[model samples]
Target: MNLLLMVTIFCVMKTIRGISLQKSTSHTFEMQEKRFVRSLVNQARLLSDWTEWSACNATICGIVGVQERYRNCSIAGEISVHLTICGQELHQAKPCEMPCITNQAVSLGSWNNWGSCSVSCGRGGVQTRQRDCLQILCTERFLQQRNCIGQNTCPQWSQWQEWSECSRSCGMGGVKIRERSCQVRRNTRVTQVVVNDILKRVSSPRQSSIQNVNASLCEGGDEVAEDAFPCMTSSSCRRNWSSWQPWSSCSATCGTGFSSGSRVCSGRIGSSCLGRPARYRRCYSPPCWSSWSGYTPCSISCGTGGGYRTRRRECRGTSTRVPQYMTCRGSNAERELCNTETCPVWGQWSRFDKCSKTCGSGRKMRTRTCVSGICRGRKFDVVSCNYQPCPYWSQWSSYTCCSVTCGPNGTKERTRACRHGGYRRAPFMNSCVGEWREQTNCSMHPCNVTPPSVFDTFECGVRNRRQTNNFSSSLLRIFGGQQSGPHGWPWQASWQYKNCNRCSWSHFCGATLVAPRWVIIAAHCIEESAQSMNHDNPGDLWSIVVGMHRFNEDGERYFIRRAIVHPNYIYRDVTDADIALVELRSEVPLTTEVVPVCLPQFSQPTVNETCFITGWGYTGPASSVSSRLSTTLLEAEVPIMNFTACQMLSPLYQEHLNSTNHMCAGDPVTAATDSCLGDSGGPLTCQRPDNTWYISGVTSFGFVECGTPGHVGIYTPLISFEEWVRTTIENNTYAAC
Candidate 1:
């Protein structure tokens, strides 16, 4: 076998490489080519193990020869062989002439019917069939398997018995249960069997399969079972209760009373419940009463005329308490007697007594007594008797001779006496009127009587002609100076309170004498004082003092008959039209010491002009209002500022300025001359080229402390109010000086 395999491998390798033995010698090849030769050797060994070999001659063939002949005749490939034989010529292998039956057809027997399934009740089962090979020389048998469906009926569970009695009576709950079994019917018998036993007994080959059935809990016992229904109870049953009904109405209106409510059992046939059917409670209605009111007025004033006083009350209650009017027991009204004292009565008067005075408004007296000792009314009265008119001044007698005849002046005298108008005159009766003597001016013809010049007549117009060379010193002294003239600024008037003493001029505001009876002042000054006094009659509260330079000196004080404050002037803020006119009760004398200031024309030009302000105000700025006003008149000169320039100095001033009726003046940037407090309503006078002085403005307001830098003084323009002043003075009467 080994030699034949070696020889086959050589032939195959030679054929694969297309190499011939005739051209080959002993030779070496590469390793890969040598491996290719070994693989072919391994394949040849496997083929030799599975192959049969045969040899054949003319008519007979051995097994090995048969294989050789089959291979030569059946295979479609080139054949090569190497043999070592001890004689005979070589020939190509051939097939023998013998009959063969390896590929012949055979007959088969009839098939058997399918067999029974292996299981009855689930998815796994089998049915089988078989057949036999029919050739006499054949021994093979044939078989087949097929799937079949089979299912047996499941056993049923019986109904459970009635539940048993509870095991416990109270507290934790007890249990009861019923029991049953899974069962099915069998042939000739009823049985309690499992599903597997039924499946085994059934006759159908496909019906032997079995299925499980759920078990049922047993009844009629106290033991708890898996499928048992619950039974809950105590050993003895009790009746159920319903909810209580609402309470009934109270029985009484004022005092304690009873009320009731009830409930019933829920189970109709049972009366075993523990509580009562009805509940009782106490109820009460609030008491009603009223309070006594105040007594009425007495009906009589005297003499035991009895009167009655009564009081009434009604039932009422407080919060949270309901009043019961019907149950209120006290009376609604009460009465008592009042005013029982006796009253006094007057007796008849005695005859009139003699007159107390012999003349001029004498009186007579009479007396009466309370008849009842307890008198309640007047007892005496008086009447006039022998009454006569009091004495009054008769007309003055003719003048007597002059005391002296002189060129300067002289005085003459006249005399009168109080005389009664009636025929009877009482001796030693005092005069009821004024003094009995009067005086007048008397002049001789030799005196020169030239009319006085305007400047000489008007003393307030006289300027302080003492010029100062040093401007700085002049500015410094502006706020501190003595009386400019003996009767300096005579037109200057002080507005005072009538209630103030004569020496308290510093407490007053200033004014200017525009007419003999009319003085112009700032309206706010009067308004402010009036508001402070809050008097019923403003006229009685104000008085004007004229003809004085010093605040402490006595002057001609006149009561203001009326003051006409500008209607449009507002008191809260400085404004234009701040001028007011005060009508005096009597006109001041037009002397060199008390002359009126000139009223400026409406067309007068005062802008940038030097003007003077005079007052009895503080001589210098002070922290507080100074009670000590300048004893001498104060005078300061300042140029009038243009309205536009004044408005630009401060927003406050711009907001309050009324240029048409107001003007500004002062050295605002220099902290020099300016009017101070208490100087309001004083004169701002300017002189014209003709040497005549005119009242230009009335002092209205200034810096709070006066003489402050960058602040100017505001004044009411007199020229603008010229018509108002004239109208006011013409409409009002002037008293004689």
Candidate 2:
């Protein structure tokens, strides 16, 4: 069995040799060569343990290689055998006469095609091939290995994995990492080894492992993964801020102050802001003041007593005309010594003039000159002189008798003539300043008479004395029946400065006659006039025109005894407490042409009640003072509005509405129905159920442009100032009714 196995192996070797001779590729040759070498190693192992065979000495040749002959060789022969296999030899011996062969060298078979490279790209790899020897006794194996190149590249970083968790949380800093696996692509089209094979051949000392990367490079790496992020943990992120609001009204009207503003941080949660939240800057608002006015005229003309003069100052803000009185640091007024000179004195009276009367009695006049010029007294005089009586018409004889009694009419006659003696005399005698004989209607009324009602004294609602002319009627028709006739609004008063040059009729404001001796006006009007004059007495400069519509025409003008402005009144960009009362020097007659309006009771009507406004102000918004002053009183009906609603109507109203002291009224939808310039301090009168008119409000101000749609007029509510009015009238002796 052993011999048969050996023979089988030898036969296999021979067959492999024959196959290798026909193979063309280096790979095939290398494979066969490996098989042959393995076979020889196995054979040698078997020979070392051989038990049934004896060694021989002979020149081993024939089919194998030749070697020198040996004599007396044992089973384990010491003879040298030259068996060439692919140009290599193996030392071993067998029985002599084993076929002596010549000692010749054998070349290796042609190389086969190279195998695939170990790597696809980027460097190291190996390839192998070999040829085979055909002899059985040859022990050398024919195989080779050489370096190879691959068309493909070695494995590299394809893509990185997602970042891992941070190393630390809630600290000054933290770290995070990510890794990628090396990969190799196979080059199947080229003479290269498979990717797996090339990777295996690399034998890299680096294990298949991860790489560390700086945590900052990772997304969201700056923040900790857990809620316990230590970095700026105590600090919270800040939100953005809006633009600053308008600076608040100055703490004081003048002097230094600070205006502060703020901003917010724009950072992520838990991030700290490294700056301040508020910023501040210095601010200054100096009081606006007028120059000191000239000294006023002395109070006394001539006397031992001295008179005083004064000057005043006012504070007007830069942005607005605010009346900052105390805000002005300097004294507003000053007084100094006035006129001390004595006046001229009149001399003694002279002889009287001749008798001036022709009958009954007469009078005389006398005059004296101020020749000494040291006294202030009258320089003229008068006294009775003539004593003789003149003969006039003597007493007439009694009537003969009554013609009738208690009838439709009755008459009685008497005859008389100029008398010289105790009887009738010549006709040439002079008569008194009247007719010598006179007759009049007698018994014009019956013996019994009825008293008249109080209403009978004056006419009410008698708007026009005659039919309106065509032009006025057309105007009335066009203006929605708002035109009024002369003396239509008896209580409406035109407020004017005496002989003012700015306007044609000296008309500047309007007022309502609430009493025979008192008129209501706006404080702002008085203040404005006083400021313009600078130290001039308001009363001296103003006059009240009553009982007339046309300011240029005939009207009862009354001197203003005094003007009492409300203490709380303010004349700023917005006017508040805008009310005042003016006392007339003399009382006006309460006739049909001049009457007083009723004062409102403590309780008043609700909003939306219809009321009437009357004034000689502008007929339209575009009319100038000279052209617009109505020759006849203008009247319009408006409804009272809620205070809040009026404020919402315009920004101007919002800034001016003093809810406690003001009311709003107007036809907001009508373009030509609102009170315009020159209407301030006019009356807003409402008629009660009894058909009696009551003064409800005093026009304070309206839009400068007059009748703007959706805009209304603001007035000083009379009811709100009822107590004030009563107290003011009672406290002031100058006020009379």
lDDT of 2 by residue, 425-508 (tens): 335433343445555343322335443322233434322334322235335422232666657677888888766465444778
The C-alpha lDDT values of all candidates are 0.59, 0.58
For model 1, residues 328-446, the per-residue Cα lDDT tens digits are: 67688888887677665667777778988866779988887667647655566789976776566654544555555435366777766666632233345544455568898765434
Q: What is the TM-score of each candidate against the true structure?
A: 0.37, 0.36
Give the best candidate by lDDT: 1
lDDT (0-100) at residue 692 of candidate 2? 72
Candidate 1 TM-score over all chains jointly: 0.37
Quality of model 1 by C-alpha lDDT: 0.59
Displacement of the residue 102 alpha carbon in candidate 2, Å: 57
